[model samples]
Target: MTKLAHHLGCFLREHLPHERGASANTCDTYAYAFQLLICFAAKRMHTQPSLLEIDQVDAPLILAFLDHLENVRRCSPRTRNARLAAIKSFFRYLEYHDVSCLDQARRIQSYR
Candidate 1:
């Protein structure tokens, strides 16, 4: 189980700024979306966000989170899609560092 903290740090600090060249607003938005995801996952798993494993963030959970973003949080479809894009980006990063999650990453990328 790869540590969410380390990978997240690399994504935010190195990947987003350097590799992707994301703007400040995009980075902030992605950060917020991930913050929500961590909270949601931690609550569901009865564990701390720092301890969350890659395997814990499976497709079913992601689908549920997206639904929650729309139905519960009242986010617009555009907002939901943007959040999904951020998640997909993170999963893509996981593809290289954590091949164990390649199928999961592909599944997320192919999500409608």
Candidate 2:
């Protein structure tokens, strides 16, 4: 584990106060989504979350993570899509911050 999860957690806890106000369940689900992605990324890199860079996380990895969520985690299709949406929202946050990823985000848009 690294600060990445902490940072994401903080983002949800502090910045997105509206999430709890609006839908705590959705916020919790999104938090799980972030946890799943970052944990998977860290595992793949064999490093901590703080060590994970935008380049190390590409579309393939993200897709693999999603597939794992479905097959391994046994998440429903609706849950998978919601998780994917959370992931896409995360990337959009990265993009907003001018983080140019090595992987094109659009290429990873597949449930299969």
Candidate 3:
């Protein structure tokens, strides 16, 4: 399994801020979405978020995360959509850095 920290760090530190020129609110929202995703993934995988892999964030898992956001966390559809957007953005960033993730990124892009 590929380590998640490096890719996520790069996306958050460089890609979003420098490349995407995301605003402070956008960054915060994306960060919040990821924070929830990582925590949910850790619980589902029975491991720490730091040990998660890119493959673990597949469409099925992301779908479940979105469900959890709405059902368990009581988030609105708009918030759920926003979170998915953040995930999609992150996956798009990953595709340029990791070709192996191309299919995965495409799947995510087609999910919604």
As a whole number from 0 to 100, the lDDT of residue 56 in candidate 2 is 60
Candidate 3 on 4-61: residue-level lDDT in tens?
8899989998889899899888888899889999999999999989999999888899
Order of quality (lDDT): 1, 3, 2
Give the TM-score ranking, best first. 3, 1, 2
Q: At residue 89, give the lDDT of candidate 1.
A: 93
**Clash pairs, model 1 backbone:** none
Clashing pairs in 3: none
- Each model's lDDT comes to 0.91, 0.67, 0.91
Model 2 earns a TM-score of 0.71
Per-model TM against the reference: 0.95, 0.71, 0.96
Worst 10 residues of 1 by lDDT: 1-10
CA RMSD of each candidate after superposition: 0.9, 3.9, 0.8
Candidate number with greatest lDDT: 1
* Candidates 2 and 3, the one with greater TM-score: 3
- Least accurate stretch of 10 residues (summed lDDT) in model 2? 96-105
Predicted candidate 2 versus true structure: per-residue lDDT over 1-112, tens digit per residue:
2234444655577545653353677678788887778888889889987777655667888778878988998989888888888777655554544444314445553333
